[model samples]
Target: MKHGALLRKISVVGVSAACCIALVGCGGTNYGYTGGVAATVNGAEIQEDTITKYIQDFRTSSDLTSDDDWGNWMKENSFDPATVRDQVIDYYVENELKKQACDEKGITVEQSQVDDEINNMKANYDSDDAWKQALSSAGLTEDQYRESVEAGLLDEALEDAVAGDAATADDSKVLDMLNTYYTMFNGAKKSSHILFASGDTEKAQEVLDQINAGTLDFAEAAKQYSTDTASAADGGNVGWDAINSFVTDYTDALDGLSVGQVSGLVTSDYGIHIIKCTDEFTCDGKATSLSAYPQEFVDYISNIVKDQSKSTAYSNWFNDYKAQADIQNNDMPENVPYNLDMTKYDNSDSSSDNSDGSSNGASADTNADASATEDSSESSNEKSSDSENSGQ
Candidate 1:
């Protein structure tokens, strides 16, 4: 899908930009009940109330006001409410796993950290009252919001531990990153074009003929006939970009073109286009060899590579943990999907079977182990400048 289409998919969560800075969620209706169990992780029950809060929070964030609204929204978005409910459950379950992992690793989130995080989040508002009002709109009390923040922090701590041991990048990984982001490996190209929708083939051909015959300037043709209005407005200048940014067909069409040379109609996923090669140059705007690039540039690329390595390290560690987690759906409502197993160890390790008899083996379960601890008053005071789930 086009980038514009993807924006619409997530536009309902208008708070995303703020959340990126504040780590606060949109909040939800007060989930009043407290006793029923939704699921158990490593023998510890995840309360139905907690699951309800997450579901409600998700709904509020998605701009769904009620269960009915959630159902209708699902239909319009081509999703099943049951599937969404399951996803919410999974999100909560992951939180539980993070808590468990932290415990095993003897990681305790400092209360001070949480307090700092909260203060920073509050700073995003005009005043404390404004922040509280925002929380209230999301159906959260000050206390409840704090709990989510702490949970988020704990998740982060676990992730940090995992990333600390991240593997160093291999040659293949470095090459992949260079191909996508840096133009030093190969010269970069800049160009502009008029994109015609797939169905407007005839119109595209007409415009192509005009440009070839000098009857119309490329920029004017693009501004007048291009369906991609955003690029058209800039006189079809897509700006300087990595050579690999374009699809194979588009790049293939540009082959053999000299500077200021316009190509014939080129087809891509977006539409048919006339490409004008404006410039090609080294990424650093210099003729330096890869070995002679400045130390700062090398360090910059190294840091980017390290960041990618850290993510991979954490994912590998987490997936292994999930493969052995012992999870049981205890009190999910009937008609909800009951297969709660998250591990890959099922059947292979008969010894890990749940005594509760819900299902046998890792295939029927997931695993993480920590003595579940209620967030204490001290831990609740800690916070971070990172995301709601940044710690994870």
Candidate 2:
């Protein structure tokens, strides 16, 4: 994770409630407010000061210091100033809602947990000054940041309590998950291809004819004639992968072939190809009994399933609670410092310039972006052990 993105992640900690609001339109009346309150959730007033501080924190952490920087950042993220204000307010409202729900369930964060979390966060930076600078940039004092961490811990406790047994992968659940993985990996096919340049079908066919007549070995033909140098060196062997991973024409040719069968001329966006199914595996039924799979792989997949189950459980609980909560997002005040004037910031030069010059930066949307970030992180982590053999 980037250092800058950490604050954004922190800012949107209890966003599941915000997602509920976005999916099923905001409930309760929008009783416009005055005198510095931004919103109210179940009679708990969310102060405008709090919202301003958070917005400023977000701006500072994101390095949107200059007016141009702010404009460019907003434009790049497809956000209008008003929408940014609303999103900040929505974050607080949702957080308050989570706090209230947690409070109702008697969930609490211990001081030790808060301290440990702060220590962990501080460890991410090089020195105490750097950590303090990060906090200052996010417009948070040590006490204020501690409070935020406590709130986060409470949210976690609430989720764990609600998820209960569903969050745990026992022996039975692990077995079921193993079967699911077996079905996918067991059915995958491995193929080798001798690729030729676009409009070189005649060359591809000539190579195929040589391989068919046994005048030239497939591996030799691939090494000699294949345009895809990466796989060509490995006897044109693209390791086992899902069918959908290949281009349409390549998939079609590979799918039609039985194990050890060579395909006819296959043309795709990459080029023309003569493909051979090098290896294939299929499970008999659902793999009801366990077969020897690496314990590490089994554990990795089990953890993933458990995490997914916890997320689903939390989503369900939050959605239910949000439906019942008497929430109200009062109108933002005109005088708040963070209520930027969209007209003053010209975003025409921004890469993501919007023709209409306005966008909905709902807090819920951040959750989706965060998920993408997490998925990208996971992909990077897996990159060392996994690779795709594109026939290009």
Candidate 3:
């Protein structure tokens, strides 16, 4: 996904398309641009206006206006005008690439197949009217949402192109991806967090030390200085999640730790995290690992992982495509609002968390070093996992 996707931000938008369309569902008016073609793949020129509309629609739909927010988000995540433009070209190319792959292998998605998929989507909210209303409020037209859905379908088709061929070179990750949701959903995860806005390592470590020494009240300390306003105010509570979206460092620290165990600050592109083992919930009324859950949630986890695997595949495919395509960014900003340094991925107050369940930069991203700010309004999308790339 790191290489194939234009930027991980799109996955946030696209994630809504999959699990919760009402969340981070950006649908906006077209941004005008008749400056000719942006790039061409095998002589197929990508229309400048189409590319512009795509970017504008995403930006406008996301409701990102502030320079600091846009710069930080764009700089850190998987988005940039040129990067996105090339992604579109890769879509066109991959569509064709998959066509060749599928045709050579004789695989397909029929009208009825697509119809069933769309029906399942419509079933999520019941009635086209309700679905349309949700999309409308999110600033998207039926046409745009349909296209978004189609792209998702296309990504799936590419995967189905070689679903279970007898090749020794198997990507068990694909099976793992396909089955993640089903495994974890069956079991619920009862978890809690310790909020810390103090980017100071000493301060964060002190809080961890107190908790380990059985002195610091997890909820009390969170209320006092945790930057996470939302959780801090409400007891450092992050409701049940079938999958762990946190970085490896954070999860590894929590491994084998029993309920009531408090962890040390774990670092990531976002910032430091002090995860607490509150309680574990299960559909069967028993405790289990985060990796194992109920059948239904496990299925959900499967699709989540599947989509991510496909996303990664798509990214890799696109990068290879970009190498051959001639993309001249004649109008590229000399020193744009945010320098696209992969190193400067976090916001200015990245390490700040509070007991209030809100992060200092939760509502913003200012090109600093870390952040655990969750977007309450738009939190349902499948976040693009970071996989460091040589190119960016």
Angstrom error of the Cα, residue 217, model 2: value is 47
lDDT of 1: 0.55
lDDT digits (tens) for residues 1-392 of candidate 2? 43454364355433222221111112233223334666788888777665555555555555555666666666655676677777766666667788787778888877988888788677768898888887766555777667667766777788888986676566666667666657655666778888888888788888888899989999999899887887888898766554225667877788788988999888877778889998776664355444444344445556666766677788888889888988777676677555566665453554334458654233234443345224433533334221133562
lDDT of 3 by residue, 1-392 (tens): 22112122223322122112211112222334445555444454445555455544545555444455554555445555456445444444444444444455566556566566556556556567876775666565656555555555555566545432221222354344334323444444545665544366778888878877889888787777566666667566554444445545555665655677776676644455677777665344233343444343444444544444444555566467556654443343334322244444454445233357443222322231112112211123333212111000
- Scored by lDDT, the top model is 2
Question: What ordering of candidates by TM-score runs from best to worst?
Answer: 2, 1, 3
Each model's lDDT comes to 0.55, 0.64, 0.47
Off by over 4 Å in 1: 1-35, 60-63, 66-68, 123-126, 133-139, 167-179, 183-294, 334-392
Off by over 4 Å in 2: 1-35, 60-76, 120-140, 168-290, 338-369, 372-392
lDDT tens digits, residues 1-392, model 1?
A: 22222122122222121111122232232356454666677876666665555545555555555444444444434345445445455655666677778889998889999898778667657777777776665555677667767766776687778786663555454444444555543455667778887788899888888888989999898789877676777677664433124566777766557679998878776677788887765553343344443333344445556655665678788888977999777545653322223233222333332367443211111122211111211122232112111101
Which prediction has the highest TM-score against the true structure? 2
Q: What TM-score should be assigned to candidate 1?
A: 0.48
